[model samples]
Target: MFPFINRSGTITPRLALIRRMAEFTGLYSWHWTPAEAEAFTSHLRSGPKPIMVSTTRGYEIPIQMFCAYISDSRYGWLEEREQRFGTVPQQVFHEWNTVLHVAEYEGDPRSRPLHYDEVQRLFDAADGRAEQIRARRMKGSVSAIRGAALVKTLYAYAYGLRRQESRGLDLVDLRRTPTNRSWN
Candidate 1:
């Protein structure tokens, strides 16, 4: 139902899950049944290093979501597939075979994220330290400012950027944008 789900970024991982499910069932998509999915889940749970419930759900979500996307009426895949393959894609996943959302942060307590206020306080402390260094005309004032900027930038793009990668950046690596006419 959503455009983002159709994008390559999302589809690639979902494709992997789809392949695994197909491999497990030894059946094509149209012939799939919820029983096979349940068997797959059981296999995951009984493995030597039995997967965590959450990890099993991670595999289930992608396959379920991708199936739902293809089965949607607006997507026209049902008609196209039925005509070409002589069968429609079946959604093997069901509530009975998949995990239900109950509560979050079920993992290690010590690894929990900081609250919003704590994050804000951390940023404020970084900026204040930079200002303190600049006020006293300290030798490392520039470095302090750069450190604060790195903190903010890391927080802004935390998923993609790393602290060491940011530290390695040079002024020469930045260039002016054509439209904005500002160094980036």
Candidate 2:
């Protein structure tokens, strides 16, 4: 049954979860209703790992994929199950019970955005560090200055440039106008 899933044979781990779901629901079959599916999901959610990690990617996605594969006509699972058990497997993880993929940013709250004062403080600290390095005539003052300048440039143009754009920037990418102003 597992061999029919994918060409690569890398679905063993996922198949383990499906087996666990069958055992949890006590159905021992793929032809489970939405109630059983909900129960299975709820059981997984109440597990130890689920308590630590709030996201349902570990439990929900694999179950949903398995249900999709069983319900799909192209896979012939529905026809085969109907012939064997006189029943067809229905999609259990519907919109009502499943989490929706709405937001692009699923990062931590601390990573959201720096406040205006926080940004000012960051720039001040970077500039102060650079100045202190210069005043002390440090051996790696040049590198320190370069890093500070890079930080300032990134912060200044953070609104205009994407993270990759700033990271992939080279010295040649910066153009100096007649007024000695640098533009990326």
lDDT of each: 0.75, 0.72
Q: Please give, for residues 1-184, the per-residue lDDT of candidate 2 as tens digits.
A: 6556673545777888788878878884565887887787676667575531225555677888887877789976677788988888777777798765666544456566666798789888877888898898888778877887887788775444677898899776666756645553
lDDT of 1 by residue, 1-184 (tens): 6865766677777787788888988987776778888898888779587876678788888778877776788977788888988888778788777877665764446765666787789789998998998899888989988888777666654433565777786655344456544333
TM-score of each: 0.50, 0.56
Q: How many residue pairs clash in each candidate?
A: 0, 0
lDDT of 1: 0.75
Candidate 2 lDDT (Cα, 0 to 1): 0.72
Lowest lDDT block of 10, candidate 1: 175-184
